[model samples]
Target: MTIAEHRTDTTHPLDPMTTAEVDAVREVLTRDGLLGEHVRFAYLGLREPGKRAVETFTGRADLDRRFLAILLDLGTGASRSVIVSTTRNTIDSTVDIDPATEGQPPIIDTEFELIEDILNADERWTAALAKRGLDPATVRAVPLSAGHYDEPGESGKRIVRSLGFQQFHEKDLPWAHPVDGLVAYVDLTGRRVTRIIDHHEYPVPQEQGNFDDPAFTGPARTTLKPIEISQPEGPSFTVEGSVVRWENWRLRLGFNEREGLTLHQLSFHDRPLLYRASIAEMVVPYADPSPVRFWQNYFDCGEYMFARYANSLELGCDCLGEIHYLDATVADDLGQPRTIRNAICMHEEDYGVLWKHTDLFSGTRETRRQRRLVISFFTTIGNYDYGFYWYLYLDGTIQLETKATGVTFTSAYPGADGAGFDYATEVAPGLGAPLHQHLFCARLDMTVDGDRNAVDEVEPERVPVGPGNPHGNAFRSRRIRLTSESVAGRLADNRAGRTWHILNPDKHNRFGQPVSYVLSPEGQPPLLADESSSIHARATFATKHLWVTRYAEEERYPAGDLVNQNPGGAGLPAWIAADRDIDGEDIVLWHSFGLTHVPRPEDWPVMPVDRAGFTLRPFGFFDRNPTLDVPSGGNGGHCAD
Candidate 1:
């Protein structure tokens, strides 16, 4: 079956599995005796389930159509992975792991099922709150304020999930840290309360404050009359099922519960460009040195599966222009098909100008207006909202961007000595939001014309005055083709004017230059975390600005698939250990892009959505300016006159 097939809404192949598919898989597992009698079938969901361990696109028949189901075996207190081949109605495989965490705690705040239980039930969580000298009424808001599951500490011999509580006084503003120093540890494996650590015993601060206070909020915000943007002649882009057809470009937009959005079978000008392109993983490692903050780091894409938290976007607030929204399906915590509506927004936006020239040489000038089609998805993880954008340009350029906004992850302050910590500002009366890092990884499967590709490193240089007494004004262009997988990966060096290109040796433009696209870094990469840090070790793909490894679908996540509690093992670094052949072979390039967040006062209530990302522009793929014929004047403004 195709990626779009099996989904209830056959309109898009990448659509989430239908409830019928979930039920069918359950039937298969039962018929084959995969779900044991004592072992409770707690969750059964779509896994995307598997692509080849390598480039299986070369052989489509090898694709496996299986139901990826997970279970909680209460009999053995373990989590199991079950694969049922829908094609044969047989249990293909079964593996059990997470025995230690079987009876461990559930992430309380964000765990919707648990949260609803606490919010509605009169007795489920009342005692736990009472033990901490808290009145249920005093709690204005309570969310899953949690961190990584560490083996040591209070968990002891039991597998547990710990959560620190951040309470707000106002009924609506849960993030306005009015109350501090409260924590809850639960044993979900056994579904029992472990303890509630409330060291700073005091009344829940009841100053009644709204951090998103409207009185003096951001220079008297003004709402202009609604301005409508329209494409009177219809969009330049068209969606035929999952496939998108635009100017000189064609590709299928696919989504999985694991990876949020993917551009598959991408091509420009009817020329094969990429077989796959998506964010393999994203690491948001906080820099607070505290015990809680130290291990509090996270692989956002892996641990949390950012794709699952995709927001149901609003029209004007999210995007402008003729926007086409896409939906995503995933099994809920209970393994039931759930649809995330409006998960992706596809539209076109005017980008200042493609190219323009006002010449003094001849009283003649030319201008090229520009517009870009954006495939975007936004997700709110805890208090932060991250927007992922893939821009399709008229000049054969593709840009991937990320915008981070939403409230900061604030921490209640220590009693004293707030000297060297990330203590940014008193967002609330007694709370401080620590500065942190948000590191993102984008995996580009550059199938330039075909899968066999090479990475060509190019650096700007100054030529020495020698050949026939050449003038010193001459510059040199140095190029190198990586021969092995080990050496193919590299870091970005702006000082050297370095830019790397994914080259197709077999294809060339009329100018005889290799048809390729260069990865251009937007800014200097972040480096506070190093190899010594376990977080970075797992995310070895972030070691360099770019990594070239032979195509292997299993290595999709540079930081490994199970990054939650996993420390520095089984990812890109481990794959590179094989030192596989890379030259003239199907290659996957992992590009790391990030920005260090040192939040300020203005970033308190909610950080303004600031954007930063990289772009892949056509290098020698085109002989001349592609937008040279773009119209110069349209006289476009707020609204049609």
Candidate 2:
């Protein structure tokens, strides 16, 4: 079974075992007669045995003792407990599980593959189809999604699936339309559908034949010349193992079960800048306010687990240019090795002009070639896809961006009575749905030169003139040092210059300013969920635009570990409630970025990639221009001088 631990925890014991090691443990467990009827592996990985004096896994690596920890969900009426096998000595300890332990049912552990398989196999499905009077050939029941019931008083591990019908249309384009609010609730373990929440929906209500309608398909006569980005000199980067070394960037790439692609031990010009950085968590809660859509709030990175949904990546579709790939090992729902090929594609792109200067007097112009290293990947969820991109520039800056694409989640419409037009637009004749928001939080563990770092904000305010300024147009800089995590939560203000930064107090550039990275938010949306909603409780990280907290190993996720069934998020908000002294400690920067999309007709078929995110540019991290040495030659053109 594969094991994974999030963040930079050196003492974490969870290590994924290979197929051979899994076989060895299976043989030992089966031999011991502990393999009950349900013999399903919930989780298997390594665990750090005891407390340690030094938490860092440095030169003392040899002291690590690997013990296999397996979580098994056996037959009915069986209690679940972890089995620890010291792989070093199989005979010494066959199963050292505490008998007092009973299996704690996971919030929701129903895998997508298993849910799809079981629903397709159940006989009740065929009967349900007959009741709907739908032919199996033209109309097929599709599994939309499945989730756990996490309300209070809800006990035991139970999961329910949502199924919708779509008429098979030869429209050629992506014609996925949900059959109006018709949902099914299935008792997964019981192997029977207890009830169907069909609203007696009809084909007229759904735009089945409209999938091929020309109104939805706008006339296309667009043609353009190909603008290709090619690497004539091959790649300007090198990858040895998981470590990448580019022009001035050096980072160890990692992919985990939680955060898909992460950069660890990131350095620029052989100097440590960040210890670890990744997307902490994300939530996409719709604002339909209806019983169906209102309760459909989703904590994607936390609940659905984006890392597990990472695509293997296609050659031309995903990335281009002298591209290099990184492989990641993931655990399947059955706890087997699932290799994610090219989980991260790294390459350089021409981001237009890097810099240009002209001495008009002499008709001389100087220009530096522009190129950026784009380390990126895409993760798909339901009908939408998210592209996570990290662009590294030669000017000592890191631009983080997330691109959202793929088909919009279209809802059925019985002809809009002019109600949802405020919230949604009818891309087709009868498909109408409200617009939604996608909130993403990036947990940047800022290791600026060292662990002990300071967090602050710089805002520009117009001078309210008296004697200081006769004209009210002059502006002043308002700087504040965030002494505690409580005061760190804030919103981005473009007018007031609401920008936050993490700085190394001890490290200063030649200008004597503290070396820091300035966080600039881009395209952030306000939280629309009510304060009383459990989604709000679980997603307090999205309430504010920015949060700075002291680094804690247990505080890796902004949303807690049990995101699938978690109502009240258990990580950042709770940690911030501690009100720790964050003046000069290892700081973690949490930036929330999102898009407030109101459906437009152009959003039909597939939504164009709408990008949102922020950039972490070097403030005083470097003295003067880091790209000062850039070659000042024109692109074979005459100088502007």
Query: Per the 3 Å backbone cut-off, how many clashing residue pairs does candidate 2 have?
Result: 14
Candidate 1 achieves a global lDDT of 0.66
Q: Stretches of candidate 2 above 4 Å error? A: 1-132, 135-153, 169-175, 192-195, 199-228, 360-364, 415-423, 633-641
TM-score for each prediction?
0.84, 0.83
Q: Model 2: per-residue lDDT, tens digit, 325-400?
A: 8766655445555677887888888776778878979986767876788998888877789999998888878888
Candidate lDDT values, in order: 0.66, 0.65
Error of 1 at 546 (Å): 1.6
What is candidate 1's TM-score against the reference?
A: 0.84
Model number with the top lDDT: 1
* Candidate 1 local Cα displacement, residue 640, angstroms: 13
**Residue pairs in steric clash, candidate 1?**
3-13, 4-13, 4-14, 102-189, 103-189, 104-188, 104-189, 109-143, 109-144
